[model samples]
Target: MPGGRLTHRDRRDIGAGLAEGLGYAEIARRIGRPTSTISREVARNGGPGGYRADHAHLATRRRARRREAIPHRDPATPPDAYGRDPDAVRDFAEQLAALMVRTGVPRMAARVLARLITDDSGSLTAADLVQRLRVSPASVSLAVRYLEGLEVIRRVREPGHRRRRYVIDDDVWLRAWMTSAQQHAMWAETAQRGVDVLDPATPAGARLAHMSQFFATLSDDMSGGSGTVEDALTVLAALRHAGTSLPVAQVATALGWPPDRVTEALSRAGPDRLTPAQLGALQGRA
Candidate 1:
Protein backbone atom coordinates (compact mmCIF):
# COMPACT_ATOMS: atom_id res chain seq x y z
CA MET A 1 0.00 0.00 0.00
CA PRO A 2 1.14 3.53 -0.76
CA GLY A 3 1.80 5.25 2.61
CA GLY A 4 -1.39 7.30 2.23
CA ARG A 5 -1.48 8.24 5.93
CA LEU A 6 1.27 9.28 8.35
CA THR A 7 1.35 9.29 12.14
CA HIS A 8 2.59 12.34 14.05
CA ARG A 9 5.95 10.62 14.48
CA ASP A 10 6.13 9.81 10.81
CA ARG A 11 5.31 13.41 9.86
CA ARG A 12 7.92 14.62 12.35
CA ASP A 13 10.57 12.40 10.81
CA ILE A 14 9.62 13.62 7.36
CA GLY A 15 9.71 17.27 8.51
CA ALA A 16 13.13 16.76 10.05
CA GLY A 17 14.52 15.80 6.65
CA LEU A 18 13.11 18.94 5.05
CA ALA A 19 14.52 21.09 7.85
CA GLU A 20 17.88 19.63 7.02
CA GLY A 21 17.25 20.76 3.35
CA LEU A 22 16.27 17.34 1.99
CA GLY A 23 13.85 17.31 -1.00
CA TYR A 24 10.19 16.32 -0.50
CA ALA A 25 10.63 13.21 -2.65
CA GLU A 26 13.66 12.12 -0.61
CA ILE A 27 11.87 12.75 2.68
CA ALA A 28 8.70 11.00 1.55
CA ARG A 29 10.72 8.02 0.27
CA ARG A 30 12.43 7.75 3.67
CA ILE A 31 9.10 8.00 5.50
CA GLY A 32 7.49 5.51 3.06
CA ARG A 33 4.91 8.14 1.96
CA PRO A 34 4.11 9.54 -1.48
CA THR A 35 6.01 12.71 -2.42
CA SER A 36 2.70 14.46 -3.20
CA THR A 37 1.25 13.47 0.20
CA ILE A 38 4.22 14.96 2.04
CA SER A 39 4.17 18.11 -0.07
CA ARG A 40 0.42 18.67 0.55
CA GLU A 41 0.72 18.12 4.28
CA VAL A 42 3.50 20.65 4.78
CA ALA A 43 1.86 23.21 2.49
CA ARG A 44 -1.54 22.89 4.14
CA ASN A 45 -0.21 23.55 7.63
CA GLY A 46 2.52 26.12 6.99
CA GLY A 47 5.09 26.33 4.27
CA PRO A 48 7.66 23.54 4.32
CA GLY A 49 10.31 25.82 5.91
CA GLY A 50 8.00 26.70 8.82
CA TYR A 51 6.25 23.35 9.30
CA ARG A 52 6.31 21.53 12.67
CA ALA A 53 4.83 18.07 12.50
CA ASP A 54 3.55 18.13 16.09
CA HIS A 55 2.10 21.64 15.78
CA ALA A 56 0.44 20.87 12.47
CA HIS A 57 -0.94 17.56 13.71
CA LEU A 58 -2.40 19.17 16.83
CA ALA A 59 -3.91 21.98 14.81
CA THR A 60 -5.56 19.43 12.53
CA ARG A 61 -6.92 17.47 15.46
CA ARG A 62 -8.20 20.58 17.22
CA ARG A 63 -10.03 21.77 14.12
CA ALA A 64 -11.62 18.35 13.76
CA ARG A 65 -12.75 18.29 17.40
CA ARG A 66 -14.18 21.80 17.23
CA ARG A 67 -16.11 20.88 14.11
CA GLU A 68 -17.43 17.76 15.74
CA ALA A 69 -18.59 19.70 18.76
CA ILE A 70 -20.75 21.85 16.47
CA PRO A 71 -23.09 18.83 15.95
CA HIS A 72 -23.97 19.81 12.37
CA ARG A 73 -20.47 18.88 11.26
CA ASP A 74 -18.76 15.51 10.97
CA PRO A 75 -17.39 13.99 14.18
CA ALA A 76 -14.22 12.77 12.56
CA THR A 77 -13.30 16.06 10.90
CA PRO A 78 -11.73 19.14 12.49
CA PRO A 79 -12.85 22.76 12.07
CA ASP A 80 -10.71 25.81 11.55
CA ALA A 81 -8.00 26.80 14.02
CA TYR A 82 -8.93 29.28 16.74
CA GLY A 83 -7.29 32.67 17.01
CA ARG A 84 -6.92 35.15 19.87
CA ASP A 85 -8.35 38.08 18.00
CA PRO A 86 -9.62 41.14 19.92
CA ASP A 87 -12.40 41.43 17.36
CA ALA A 88 -13.84 38.24 18.77
CA VAL A 89 -14.32 39.92 22.13
CA ARG A 90 -16.09 42.86 20.49
CA ASP A 91 -18.31 40.48 18.55
CA PHE A 92 -19.18 38.67 21.75
CA ALA A 93 -20.28 41.92 23.37
CA GLU A 94 -22.51 42.88 20.44
CA GLN A 95 -23.98 39.40 20.26
CA LEU A 96 -24.74 39.50 23.98
CA ALA A 97 -26.46 42.88 23.71
CA ALA A 98 -28.57 41.64 20.82
CA LEU A 99 -29.56 38.53 22.71
CA MET A 100 -30.57 40.55 25.76
CA VAL A 101 -32.66 42.89 23.64
CA ARG A 102 -34.47 39.89 22.23
CA THR A 103 -35.33 38.69 25.75
CA GLY A 104 -37.54 41.76 26.43
CA VAL A 105 -34.77 43.70 28.15
CA PRO A 106 -35.06 47.32 27.05
CA ARG A 107 -32.33 48.42 24.67
CA MET A 108 -30.59 50.81 27.05
CA ALA A 109 -30.80 48.36 29.96
CA ALA A 110 -29.49 45.63 27.70
CA ARG A 111 -26.52 47.77 26.76
CA VAL A 112 -25.65 48.38 30.39
CA LEU A 113 -25.99 44.68 31.27
CA ALA A 114 -23.85 43.71 28.32
CA ARG A 115 -21.14 46.09 29.47
CA LEU A 116 -21.24 44.77 33.01
CA ILE A 117 -20.98 41.18 31.82
CA THR A 118 -18.06 42.01 29.54
CA ASP A 119 -16.23 44.15 32.06
CA ASP A 120 -13.24 42.60 33.74
CA SER A 121 -14.28 43.92 37.16
CA GLY A 122 -18.05 43.37 36.77
CA SER A 123 -18.53 47.11 37.25
CA LEU A 124 -17.79 50.41 35.55
CA THR A 125 -17.75 54.03 36.58
CA ALA A 126 -20.31 56.09 34.65
CA ALA A 127 -17.48 57.80 32.83
CA ASP A 128 -15.99 54.46 31.84
CA LEU A 129 -19.35 53.35 30.52
CA VAL A 130 -19.85 56.57 28.58
CA GLN A 131 -16.42 56.32 27.02
CA ARG A 132 -16.46 52.61 26.23
CA LEU A 133 -20.04 52.53 24.99
CA ARG A 134 -19.53 55.64 22.86
CA VAL A 135 -22.73 57.11 24.18
CA SER A 136 -23.45 60.31 26.10
CA PRO A 137 -23.22 60.45 29.89
CA ALA A 138 -26.99 60.84 29.90
CA SER A 139 -27.49 57.46 28.20
CA VAL A 140 -25.36 55.66 30.75
CA SER A 141 -27.13 57.52 33.56
CA LEU A 142 -30.60 56.61 32.34
CA ALA A 143 -29.69 53.04 31.52
CA VAL A 144 -28.11 52.52 34.95
CA ARG A 145 -31.12 54.02 36.75
CA TYR A 146 -33.51 51.64 35.00
CA LEU A 147 -31.23 48.72 35.75
CA GLU A 148 -31.27 49.73 39.41
CA GLY A 149 -35.06 49.82 39.39
CA LEU A 150 -35.13 46.36 37.86
CA GLU A 151 -32.81 45.26 40.70
CA VAL A 152 -30.19 43.90 38.35
CA ILE A 153 -27.23 46.08 39.37
CA ARG A 154 -26.19 48.24 42.30
CA ARG A 155 -24.25 51.47 42.28
CA VAL A 156 -20.95 52.11 44.04
CA ARG A 157 -18.54 55.02 44.53
CA GLU A 158 -14.82 55.27 44.68
CA PRO A 159 -13.10 56.72 47.75
CA GLY A 160 -12.69 60.49 47.58
CA HIS A 161 -14.02 60.59 44.01
CA ARG A 162 -16.97 62.52 42.64
CA ARG A 163 -17.82 59.81 40.09
CA ARG A 164 -20.22 56.93 40.71
CA ARG A 165 -19.94 53.38 39.40
CA TYR A 166 -22.50 50.63 38.76
CA VAL A 167 -21.88 47.03 39.74
CA ILE A 168 -23.46 43.60 39.34
CA ASP A 169 -23.03 41.38 42.37
CA ASP A 170 -22.84 37.65 43.08
CA ASP A 171 -26.23 37.99 44.81
CA VAL A 172 -27.88 39.90 42.00
CA TRP A 173 -30.51 37.21 41.42
CA LEU A 174 -31.29 37.00 45.13
CA ARG A 175 -31.99 40.74 45.20
CA ALA A 176 -34.03 40.31 42.03
CA TRP A 177 -36.24 37.99 44.05
CA MET A 178 -36.98 40.81 46.48
CA THR A 179 -37.76 43.12 43.62
CA SER A 180 -40.22 40.52 42.39
CA ALA A 181 -41.80 40.40 45.83
CA GLN A 182 -42.30 44.15 45.86
CA GLN A 183 -43.93 44.06 42.42
CA HIS A 184 -46.16 41.22 43.53
CA ALA A 185 -47.24 43.24 46.56
CA MET A 186 -48.34 46.07 44.27
CA TRP A 187 -50.34 43.68 42.08
CA ALA A 188 -51.85 41.94 45.13
CA GLU A 189 -52.84 45.25 46.61
CA THR A 190 -54.48 46.28 43.37
CA ALA A 191 -56.35 43.00 43.02
CA GLN A 192 -57.50 43.11 46.65
CA ARG A 193 -58.91 46.58 46.10
CA GLY A 194 -60.84 45.35 43.05
CA VAL A 195 -62.31 42.45 45.09
CA ASP A 196 -63.36 44.82 47.86
CA VAL A 197 -64.97 47.25 45.44
CA LEU A 198 -66.81 44.57 43.40
CA ASP A 199 -68.04 42.35 46.27
CA PRO A 200 -65.74 39.75 47.80
CA ALA A 201 -68.35 36.96 47.67
CA THR A 202 -68.97 37.17 43.92
CA PRO A 203 -67.37 34.81 41.39
CA ALA A 204 -65.49 37.73 39.83
CA GLY A 205 -64.30 38.84 43.25
CA ALA A 206 -63.30 35.24 44.04
CA ARG A 207 -61.14 35.07 40.91
CA LEU A 208 -59.37 38.30 41.79
CA ALA A 209 -58.98 37.07 45.36
CA HIS A 210 -57.38 33.92 44.05
CA MET A 211 -55.02 36.07 42.00
CA SER A 212 -54.09 38.01 45.12
CA GLN A 213 -53.44 34.84 47.04
CA PHE A 214 -51.21 33.44 44.31
CA PHE A 215 -49.09 36.55 43.99
CA ALA A 216 -48.89 37.00 47.75
CA THR A 217 -47.59 33.47 48.17
CA LEU A 218 -45.02 33.98 45.43
CA SER A 219 -44.04 37.33 46.96
CA ASP A 220 -43.57 35.80 50.39
CA ASP A 221 -41.42 33.09 48.93
CA MET A 222 -39.32 35.69 47.16
CA SER A 223 -39.06 38.35 49.88
CA GLY A 224 -37.39 36.20 52.54
CA GLY A 225 -38.07 39.24 54.81
CA SER A 226 -36.18 41.98 56.66
CA GLY A 227 -32.72 40.50 56.20
CA THR A 228 -32.98 40.84 52.43
CA VAL A 229 -34.54 44.29 52.89
CA GLU A 230 -31.56 45.38 54.96
CA ASP A 231 -29.17 44.03 52.38
CA ALA A 232 -30.91 45.91 49.56
CA LEU A 233 -30.97 49.06 51.67
CA THR A 234 -27.23 48.85 52.20
CA VAL A 235 -26.57 48.61 48.47
CA LEU A 236 -28.97 51.44 47.66
CA ALA A 237 -27.49 53.63 50.37
CA ALA A 238 -24.02 53.14 48.93
CA LEU A 239 -25.43 54.07 45.54
CA ARG A 240 -27.13 57.20 46.92
CA HIS A 241 -23.81 58.35 48.22
CA ALA A 242 -22.32 57.73 44.81
CA GLY A 243 -25.09 59.62 43.01
CA THR A 244 -23.54 62.90 44.10
CA SER A 245 -21.04 62.32 41.37
CA LEU A 246 -23.76 62.87 38.77
CA PRO A 247 -24.58 66.36 37.55
CA VAL A 248 -27.98 67.77 38.49
CA ALA A 249 -29.16 67.94 34.87
CA GLN A 250 -28.01 64.40 34.20
CA VAL A 251 -29.78 63.20 37.32
CA ALA A 252 -33.01 64.93 36.34
CA THR A 253 -32.82 63.44 32.87
CA ALA A 254 -32.08 59.96 34.19
CA LEU A 255 -35.04 60.00 36.60
CA GLY A 256 -37.22 61.46 33.81
CA TRP A 257 -38.47 64.14 36.12
CA PRO A 258 -37.86 67.72 37.10
CA PRO A 259 -34.94 68.44 39.42
CA ASP A 260 -37.36 69.33 42.21
CA ARG A 261 -39.08 65.96 41.93
CA VAL A 262 -35.71 64.32 41.91
CA THR A 263 -34.82 66.20 45.10
CA GLU A 264 -38.12 65.23 46.72
CA ALA A 265 -37.83 61.53 45.88
CA LEU A 266 -34.27 61.44 47.11
CA SER A 267 -35.28 63.12 50.37
CA ARG A 268 -38.35 60.89 50.77
CA ALA A 269 -36.40 57.71 50.23
CA GLY A 270 -34.13 59.21 52.89
CA PRO A 271 -30.55 58.03 52.75
CA ASP A 272 -32.02 54.65 51.76
CA ARG A 273 -32.67 55.06 48.02
CA LEU A 274 -29.69 55.81 45.77
CA THR A 275 -31.27 58.98 44.40
CA PRO A 276 -29.21 61.78 42.92
CA ALA A 277 -30.26 64.41 45.43
CA GLN A 278 -29.01 62.31 48.30
CA LEU A 279 -25.70 61.80 46.57
CA GLY A 280 -25.42 65.52 45.96
CA ALA A 281 -26.30 66.28 49.56
CA LEU A 282 -23.93 63.64 50.92
CA GLN A 283 -21.11 65.13 48.88
CA GLY A 284 -21.63 68.50 50.59
CA ARG A 285 -20.79 66.92 53.92
CA ALA A 286 -17.46 65.75 52.55
Candidate 2:
Protein backbone atom coordinates (compact mmCIF):
# COMPACT_ATOMS: atom_id res chain seq x y z
CA MET A 1 0.00 0.00 0.00
CA PRO A 2 1.13 3.56 -0.64
CA GLY A 3 2.08 5.04 2.73
CA GLY A 4 3.79 8.34 1.94
CA ARG A 5 2.24 11.58 0.76
CA LEU A 6 0.26 11.41 -2.47
CA THR A 7 2.14 12.43 -5.61
CA HIS A 8 0.80 14.55 -8.50
CA ARG A 9 0.24 11.37 -10.54
CA ASP A 10 -1.78 9.91 -7.67
CA ARG A 11 -3.92 13.04 -7.57
CA ARG A 12 -4.44 12.88 -11.35
CA ASP A 13 -5.62 9.29 -10.99
CA ILE A 14 -7.95 10.32 -8.18
CA GLY A 15 -9.45 13.06 -10.30
CA ALA A 16 -9.84 10.62 -13.23
CA GLY A 17 -11.52 8.10 -10.95
CA LEU A 18 -13.89 10.74 -9.61
CA ALA A 19 -14.72 11.85 -13.16
CA GLU A 20 -15.41 8.23 -14.03
CA GLY A 21 -17.97 8.14 -11.17
CA LEU A 22 -15.98 5.60 -9.18
CA GLY A 23 -16.54 5.33 -5.42
CA TYR A 24 -13.83 6.15 -2.91
CA ALA A 25 -13.26 2.48 -2.02
CA GLU A 26 -12.75 1.41 -5.66
CA ILE A 27 -10.54 4.43 -6.36
CA ALA A 28 -8.50 3.64 -3.28
CA ARG A 29 -8.16 0.00 -4.32
CA ARG A 30 -6.85 1.01 -7.74
CA ILE A 31 -4.40 3.52 -6.18
CA GLY A 32 -3.21 1.20 -3.40
CA ARG A 33 -4.42 3.70 -0.71
CA PRO A 34 -7.07 3.72 1.98
CA THR A 35 -10.63 4.84 1.21
CA SER A 36 -10.35 7.46 3.95
CA THR A 37 -7.36 8.98 2.21
CA ILE A 38 -9.17 9.29 -1.09
CA SER A 39 -12.32 10.70 0.53
CA ARG A 40 -10.39 13.24 2.63
CA GLU A 41 -8.37 14.32 -0.37
CA VAL A 42 -11.46 14.97 -2.43
CA ALA A 43 -13.30 16.67 0.42
CA ARG A 44 -10.42 18.98 1.32
CA ASN A 45 -9.61 20.01 -2.24
CA GLY A 46 -13.07 20.10 -3.81
CA GLY A 47 -16.00 17.73 -3.94
CA PRO A 48 -16.09 15.18 -6.75
CA GLY A 49 -17.76 17.49 -9.21
CA GLY A 50 -15.42 20.40 -8.50
CA TYR A 51 -12.08 18.58 -8.02
CA ARG A 52 -9.14 19.43 -10.32
CA ALA A 53 -5.96 17.37 -10.17
CA ASP A 54 -3.50 20.23 -10.58
CA HIS A 55 -5.22 22.45 -7.99
CA ALA A 56 -5.50 19.64 -5.46
CA HIS A 57 -1.83 18.67 -5.91
CA LEU A 58 -0.68 22.27 -5.50
CA ALA A 59 -2.93 22.75 -2.44
CA THR A 60 -1.47 19.64 -0.82
CA ARG A 61 2.09 20.91 -1.31
CA ARG A 62 1.18 24.31 0.18
CA ARG A 63 -0.41 22.71 3.22
CA ALA A 64 2.61 20.44 3.71
CA ARG A 65 4.98 23.39 3.47
CA ARG A 66 2.92 25.39 5.94
CA ARG A 67 2.93 22.53 8.44
CA GLU A 68 6.71 22.12 7.99
CA ALA A 69 7.28 25.80 8.77
CA ILE A 70 5.62 25.54 12.21
CA PRO A 71 8.19 25.13 15.02
CA HIS A 72 8.18 21.75 16.78
CA ARG A 73 7.75 21.60 20.56
CA ASP A 74 10.17 19.51 22.60
CA PRO A 75 8.53 16.83 24.75
CA ALA A 76 11.41 16.91 27.25
CA THR A 77 10.46 20.39 28.47
CA PRO A 78 9.60 20.98 32.13
CA PRO A 79 6.02 20.55 33.27
CA ASP A 80 3.61 23.44 33.81
CA ALA A 81 2.57 24.88 37.19
CA TYR A 82 0.08 22.04 37.65
CA GLY A 83 2.84 19.51 36.87
CA ARG A 84 1.36 18.63 33.50
CA ASP A 85 3.57 17.80 30.52
CA PRO A 86 2.57 20.34 27.84
CA ASP A 87 3.22 18.00 24.92
CA ALA A 88 1.22 15.22 26.55
CA VAL A 89 -1.67 17.60 27.21
CA ARG A 90 -1.66 18.69 23.56
CA ASP A 91 -1.66 15.08 22.32
CA PHE A 92 -4.56 14.20 24.62
CA ALA A 93 -6.53 17.23 23.48
CA GLU A 94 -5.99 16.28 19.84
CA GLN A 95 -7.06 12.72 20.55
CA LEU A 96 -10.23 13.94 22.26
CA ALA A 97 -10.96 16.27 19.34
CA ALA A 98 -10.49 13.40 16.88
CA LEU A 99 -12.92 11.27 18.86
CA MET A 100 -15.47 14.07 18.87
CA VAL A 101 -15.04 14.45 15.12
CA ARG A 102 -15.81 10.76 14.70
CA THR A 103 -18.96 11.30 16.78
CA GLY A 104 -20.21 13.95 14.29
CA VAL A 105 -18.76 17.21 15.64
CA PRO A 106 -17.16 19.51 13.10
CA ARG A 107 -13.35 19.41 13.21
CA MET A 108 -12.73 22.99 14.29
CA ALA A 109 -15.59 22.95 16.82
CA ALA A 110 -14.33 19.70 18.35
CA ARG A 111 -10.83 21.15 18.67
CA VAL A 112 -12.22 24.20 20.44
CA LEU A 113 -14.40 22.09 22.78
CA ALA A 114 -11.52 19.76 23.63
CA ARG A 115 -9.28 22.72 24.44
CA LEU A 116 -11.93 24.27 26.70
CA ILE A 117 -12.60 20.95 28.46
CA THR A 118 -8.90 20.44 29.24
CA ASP A 119 -8.23 23.94 30.53
CA ASP A 120 -7.49 24.38 34.25
CA SER A 121 -10.02 27.17 34.67
CA GLY A 122 -12.53 25.77 32.16
CA SER A 123 -12.76 29.29 30.78
CA LEU A 124 -10.91 31.24 28.12
CA THR A 125 -11.25 34.41 26.19
CA ALA A 126 -11.29 34.40 22.40
CA ALA A 127 -7.68 35.60 22.34
CA ASP A 128 -6.61 32.75 24.58
CA LEU A 129 -8.24 30.20 22.27
CA VAL A 130 -6.77 31.74 19.15
CA GLN A 131 -3.26 31.75 20.66
CA ARG A 132 -3.52 28.24 22.13
CA LEU A 133 -5.09 26.65 19.04
CA ARG A 134 -2.99 28.74 16.64
CA VAL A 135 -6.07 29.45 14.61
CA SER A 136 -7.55 32.73 13.45
CA PRO A 137 -9.99 34.72 15.57
CA ALA A 138 -12.74 34.03 13.05
CA SER A 139 -12.29 30.30 13.39
CA VAL A 140 -12.47 30.50 17.17
CA SER A 141 -15.55 32.72 16.98
CA LEU A 142 -17.33 30.33 14.63
CA ALA A 143 -16.45 27.28 16.72
CA VAL A 144 -17.63 28.92 19.94
CA ARG A 145 -20.90 29.95 18.30
CA TYR A 146 -21.50 26.36 17.24
CA LEU A 147 -20.73 25.03 20.72
CA GLU A 148 -22.92 27.69 22.34
CA GLY A 149 -25.83 26.69 20.12
CA LEU A 150 -25.53 23.13 21.42
CA GLU A 151 -25.40 24.37 25.06
CA VAL A 152 -22.07 22.59 25.56
CA ILE A 153 -20.40 25.84 26.57
CA ARG A 154 -21.56 29.32 27.51
CA ARG A 155 -20.27 32.88 27.42
CA VAL A 156 -20.00 35.11 30.45
CA ARG A 157 -18.45 38.46 31.26
CA GLU A 158 -16.55 39.04 34.45
CA PRO A 159 -17.39 42.19 36.31
CA GLY A 160 -15.55 45.19 34.87
CA HIS A 161 -14.16 43.08 32.04
CA ARG A 162 -14.62 44.19 28.45
CA ARG A 163 -14.18 40.79 26.85
CA ARG A 164 -16.47 37.81 27.41
CA ARG A 165 -15.03 34.40 28.22
CA TYR A 166 -16.26 31.07 27.00
CA VAL A 167 -16.67 28.75 29.92
CA ILE A 168 -17.26 25.02 30.44
CA ASP A 169 -18.50 24.27 33.93
CA ASP A 170 -19.28 21.13 35.95
CA ASP A 171 -22.90 21.46 34.80
CA VAL A 172 -21.93 21.69 31.15
CA TRP A 173 -22.84 18.08 30.50
CA LEU A 174 -26.17 18.47 32.32
CA ARG A 175 -27.05 21.51 30.24
CA ALA A 176 -26.10 19.72 27.03
CA TRP A 177 -28.13 16.69 28.03
CA MET A 178 -31.19 18.83 28.74
CA THR A 179 -30.76 20.60 25.43
CA SER A 180 -30.80 17.24 23.65
CA ALA A 181 -33.88 16.13 25.56
CA GLN A 182 -35.62 19.37 24.69
CA GLN A 183 -34.84 18.78 21.04
CA HIS A 184 -36.27 15.28 21.28
CA ALA A 185 -39.45 16.68 22.84
CA MET A 186 -39.75 19.09 19.93
CA TRP A 187 -39.34 16.19 17.48
CA ALA A 188 -42.00 14.20 19.35
CA GLU A 189 -44.42 17.10 19.27
CA THR A 190 -43.81 17.71 15.57
CA ALA A 191 -44.28 14.05 14.77
CA GLN A 192 -47.57 14.01 16.66
CA ARG A 193 -48.69 17.03 14.71
CA GLY A 194 -47.99 15.13 11.53
CA VAL A 195 -50.10 12.25 12.81
CA ASP A 196 -52.95 14.65 13.48
CA VAL A 197 -52.75 16.06 9.98
CA LEU A 198 -52.77 12.68 8.25
CA ASP A 199 -55.33 9.87 8.49
CA PRO A 200 -54.45 7.70 11.47
CA ALA A 201 -54.94 4.51 9.45
CA THR A 202 -52.57 5.63 6.70
CA PRO A 203 -49.04 4.16 6.56
CA ALA A 204 -47.36 7.57 6.94
CA GLY A 205 -49.58 8.48 9.89
CA ALA A 206 -48.83 5.21 11.66
CA ARG A 207 -45.15 5.75 11.03
CA LEU A 208 -45.38 9.26 12.49
CA ALA A 209 -47.31 7.97 15.50
CA HIS A 210 -44.56 5.43 16.20
CA MET A 211 -41.90 8.11 15.78
CA SER A 212 -43.77 10.37 18.18
CA GLN A 213 -44.00 7.68 20.83
CA PHE A 214 -40.34 6.73 20.44
CA PHE A 215 -39.10 10.30 20.76
CA ALA A 216 -41.48 11.05 23.63
CA THR A 217 -40.24 8.04 25.56
CA LEU A 218 -36.62 8.91 24.80
CA SER A 219 -37.14 12.53 25.85
CA ASP A 220 -38.79 11.54 29.11
CA ASP A 221 -36.00 9.10 29.87
CA MET A 222 -33.28 11.59 29.06
CA SER A 223 -34.93 14.45 30.91
CA GLY A 224 -34.06 12.83 34.28
CA GLY A 225 -37.67 12.32 35.33
CA SER A 226 -37.44 8.51 35.27
CA GLY A 227 -35.66 8.65 38.63
CA THR A 228 -39.04 9.26 40.27
CA VAL A 229 -40.30 5.92 38.94
CA GLU A 230 -37.12 4.23 40.12
CA ASP A 231 -37.56 5.70 43.58
CA ALA A 232 -41.13 4.43 43.74
CA LEU A 233 -39.97 0.97 42.69
CA THR A 234 -37.24 1.01 45.30
CA VAL A 235 -39.80 1.81 47.99
CA LEU A 236 -41.99 -1.07 46.83
CA ALA A 237 -39.03 -3.46 46.58
CA ALA A 238 -38.05 -2.69 50.17
CA LEU A 239 -41.58 -3.54 51.39
CA ARG A 240 -41.72 -6.68 49.24
CA HIS A 241 -38.35 -7.95 50.51
CA ALA A 242 -39.46 -7.52 54.13
CA GLY A 243 -42.72 -9.46 53.37
CA THR A 244 -44.60 -6.88 55.45
CA SER A 245 -45.50 -3.21 55.56
CA LEU A 246 -42.62 -1.06 56.80
CA PRO A 247 -42.80 2.48 58.18
CA VAL A 248 -41.30 5.23 56.04
CA ALA A 249 -38.53 5.72 58.62
CA GLN A 250 -37.54 2.04 58.50
CA VAL A 251 -37.66 1.97 54.70
CA ALA A 252 -35.56 5.17 54.56
CA THR A 253 -33.00 3.62 56.88
CA ALA A 254 -32.84 0.48 54.72
CA LEU A 255 -32.50 2.51 51.49
CA GLY A 256 -30.19 5.20 52.93
CA TRP A 257 -32.69 7.94 52.16
CA PRO A 258 -34.47 10.58 54.20
CA PRO A 259 -37.79 9.52 55.74
CA ASP A 260 -39.72 12.23 53.89
CA ARG A 261 -38.30 11.04 50.54
CA VAL A 262 -39.34 7.48 51.37
CA THR A 263 -42.81 8.70 52.30
CA GLU A 264 -43.11 10.60 49.01
CA ALA A 265 -42.06 7.56 47.03
CA LEU A 266 -44.56 5.44 48.94
CA SER A 267 -47.32 7.98 48.27
CA ARG A 268 -46.53 7.88 44.52
CA ALA A 269 -46.55 4.07 44.40
CA GLY A 270 -50.35 3.71 44.90
CA PRO A 271 -52.52 1.21 43.02
CA ASP A 272 -53.25 3.69 40.17
CA ARG A 273 -49.55 4.01 39.38
CA LEU A 274 -48.44 0.37 39.86
CA THR A 275 -49.01 -2.86 37.96
CA PRO A 276 -50.62 -5.86 39.73
CA ALA A 277 -47.13 -7.22 40.57
CA GLN A 278 -45.96 -3.84 41.88
CA LEU A 279 -49.16 -3.40 43.92
CA GLY A 280 -48.64 -6.87 45.37
CA ALA A 281 -45.13 -5.77 46.31
CA LEU A 282 -46.50 -2.62 47.95
CA GLN A 283 -48.14 -4.73 50.69
CA GLY A 284 -50.28 -1.82 52.04
CA ARG A 285 -47.30 0.36 53.00
CA ALA A 286 -48.34 3.86 54.09
For all candidates in order, the CA lDDT equals 0.72, 0.84
Candidate 2 per-residue lDDT, tens place, 145-259, comes to: 9998887889999789889999998998887788899999999999999999996699999999999999998998788554366778888888899999887788889999988
What TM-score would every model get versus the actual structure? 0.44, 0.60
User: CA lDDT of 237 in candidate 1?
Assistant: 56
Candidate 1 local lDDT, 1-286, one digit each (tens):
4644577888789778978999889997887888777766665455555578888789768766765665463434442344444444544565566566656777667877887987668988888887666667888889988899877898877889877789999788777777778999888889999999878899999999999888876776577532234434443454586765565466666546566645544454565556889798879898
How many residue pairs of model 1 clash at the backbone? 6
Best-performing candidate as measured by lDDT: 2
In Å, residue 224's CA in model 2 sits off its true spot by: 3.3
What TM-score should be assigned to candidate 2? 0.60
